[model samples]
Target: MKRREFIASAAPLGLLFSLGLGDVPFANAQTAGGTPVPGGVLNVAVSPEPTLLTSAFITTMNIGQVSSKILEGLVSYDLNLQPVPALATSWSTAPDGLTVTFRLRQNVKWHDGKQFGAADVQYTLLEVWKKLHPFGRAAFANVTAVDTPDPHTVVIRLSSPAPYLINYINTYGAQILPRHLYEGKDVLTNPVNNAPVGTGPFVFKEWVKGSHVRLARNPDYWQKGQPYLDGVVFRFIPDAAARTVALEAGEIDVALGSSIPLSNLNKFQDKSRYSINLDDGRYLATIFLTQFNVRKPYFADKRVRQAFAHAIDRNALLKVVFLGYGKPATGPVPSSVVNYYAAQTRQYPYDLKKAAALLDEAGLKPGKDGKRLRIALDYDAGGGVTATRPAEFIKQSLARVGIEVELRGGDTASYLRRVFTDQDYDLMISSLHRLPDPTLGVQRLFWTRNIIKGAPWTNGSGYSNPRLDTIMEAAGREADVARRRALITEWQQIVQEDVPVLDLVEQTWVTVSTARFQKTALQGDGLFASYADAWLTPKKA
Candidate 1:
């Protein structure tokens, strides 16, 4: 059974709209007849508030969910996952695959009333993404230059063939930013990050702290007569049960990111009241793993890392923690991404005896108090039960082997800073997306160059292997498909042997919404889409 789905409205508007809450704006939205209605608010439930609006630098799921609507990518993917036009009308690649060119759409303007052009794309790629973006550091490593012949034409020059470069030009990945605003400023600390300006279907309205983020429709949207809904309000409901109850009560129209607990999904199984999506808007193929601070002397030993892997039972973690929503992962890449996934590598089946022996070999024997070593474990507080439960489970499992774990947690914003920026964690638990391609997702987690401070979803472990880096860099530039796959396989094996981080499970999340919502499934990403064409139908007569 497909475990994850989102919730949309099938009934009429709730009392919240009738009472008139302008601070968190909502409307009596949707169609009267068969045609889609132009006016109404699509109230969405986003569990944790995003740290910022734009996903150009930080690819946090919540950030992508909201920012995708405001920021327009050069292209958007089709139902077949093929690149289609968004900001860039047309594009071409050189025979050698080293040079690619894009023709920007004319008459398109940024949210701040500036003309969108090649200069915006050029600066976003070279200055922002390459320098600051966690994944872009690895994905766009070979990018030598982004030349703009005219205001509408952008020519990208690469040092080697990057066949997978086209896959990440979408809004959720390499979002285009305005050159005028970001020209001579510190991007990370820029005030505009809190209130983004973009070229998309939605305009930046207001974000009430610890409340909701409200967005209004962009009247000057490049797509003609589209983005049918008037606006969107993503409410922050911290509790999973409360989010589900709100959806059931019609307070919120939709809920994505599996905010509702898996055990509660049966209540919404009645198709008449609720609609479900399996593989839609879920471009993020998530891998739930624990990253260790390898800089610490206790965790630096290879045997210690291997012992930690053997200590945890992956099968039990899948069944108990995730409620069997996913399968145990083999390596960095999950089985869902069949193109590059490595089927065979070193396996760490549950073996208490082996775990104890390995720990002893690493000179981490039980002391007078029966404690081998003490460590702190941090987790994403926003992930609700899914994240919190796993931390507890790992702690329990590791306890049997004489390792004492102190669970640490905080808000999503502070958690990212603690682990990635401060590097304050001994062991950090995070569920990160492996994206559509390994170059865009998997490589960033292990690549030496991607251990950037203040960047989330990066190599915070401080682990580096020159051979693995060589393999990853070659795979990124490799033109031949078979050769690239082989290189990727080798990369997985090296990580498995080194055990920098324990790749636990590959999760398949769901999106639940009502049938009244339209055009959400048009894009391959499902609920993670820009929602430009998304609108609601009228209540059942």
Candidate 2:
């Protein structure tokens, strides 16, 4: 079956929006109708050099934003958060919904000049995606086989129906890798990861470790006359204040992951010089959470987790830490995911008396020193003040309930190792990007099968509820949209009652860009976009 044939046959699931041209406007680009001038470099500010260049293993958004320019997936989400074609020209699903076929685009070449075909997709799905990807393991759990009948045709046969498979393939799901290069080599230690070869708009050039990573435009890009800029340079700033200073001084053209300090956002309101885009965050669904390690004796009790939840006030965290840039989250899924979000779930109101009562009921009584117990809490310092400030606030709140928290702050790598690998920390304050669907993001938080020992972002909390797991599995296979949503709602209620992970706040990301750049449309997925769609505007004399 062809791409158009599938679209015509399958009824619209309401999740698929209209493919209108430029339906979602770029947050702050000057769209006033001047010709796009090419051949200039676009400078971006990134914090803390990414430990891994491969998106298959990366936990932080910094690495994905940088690597996206070098790697092209089978599909990408547009500004409206709808699935759009990338490497695959079109796709169709079987009548039973257990099979999916993708029609590849011809003449697409990898950076190494080799033809991109079905084999590349097959290898990426079997080796990297199904086995190694954090979200893919659960998303593709029902996949029985991936068949490539021809060079341009790829078919996926599943044991059951997966409605959200297309959504995953659009974002982190289907990043195609060259089978010839990664087939027989150690994928984790492959040299190609440091210097990648992809079919993206930019070609990998050089990396100067902790300083910067550079990329040149791909002249032979599939989208002809694209990647308007000559090159792109990502500068590692680490400090949010320093990133804002660089943007103000015109040292950088754009900030990738909203590294600019929230207090300094008002200073860049000049229309002619800078464009500040505080996006609606529909595509970039992120939920700030306080994760508990149920493996620890102190946190194994549900009462203790509920006590901590009632102690901390999410509204205060929004104002004090985010500067009123986000909303208080209710569950693992953020409000931006409108289809499956259950707003009526259990809410934890801030009450010190209730918190104290619950702690006492859990048998955690204070000693003569007036401290119930001491627990270690860690936060990611790479997120700058946004992360550290919240940790400080949580420490103060937990102390009021007689639970002493030793706050520990570290870089992205250290925090990942402690929580994911070592599993030594008692509590962790971190943010996870909630995808458009619950199956893509929320399932990994509580799924028992996803509790991979060495994995960085998959069920690190070691949380598993048999009832919730069954609901998640049924939701993945349910073809009826309403039935799947009902299943998701049931799972949310269970998670709220269980209190495995406490939802804190949903953040709103702000991206700042210089007026020298044009057509800078920030997609729903986050601040980053295919630089190919962006062009440099000529400066006035």
TM-score to native of every candidate shown: 0.81, 0.86
Pairs of colliding residues, candidate 2: 26-521, 283-524
**Candidate 1 residue-wise lDDT, 347-387, digit = tens:** 89899889999999999999999899999998765554555
lDDT of 2 by residue, 1-541 (tens): 0111111111110111112112322334334245778888999887657766657543346667788788877777755567778888899999898999999989999999999999999998988888877567767778889999999999999999999888777434456678888999988889998888888899999999989999999999999889889999999886667888898888999875556655676777778898765542346576677899999998899999999999999878766665555667788777767778898888889999999999999999988988998999987765545556778899999999898989898876788789989998999976666678888877888999889776766788998888889999899899888999999999999999888899887655556788776664546654445677777787678
lDDT of 1 at 260: 61
In model 2, where do residues sit more than 4 Å from their true spots? 1-35, 51-60, 280-284, 296-298, 360-374, 380-386, 410-424, 452-454, 526-528
Error of 1 at 24 (Å): 36
Choose the strongest candidate by lDDT: 1
Clashes of each: 16, 2
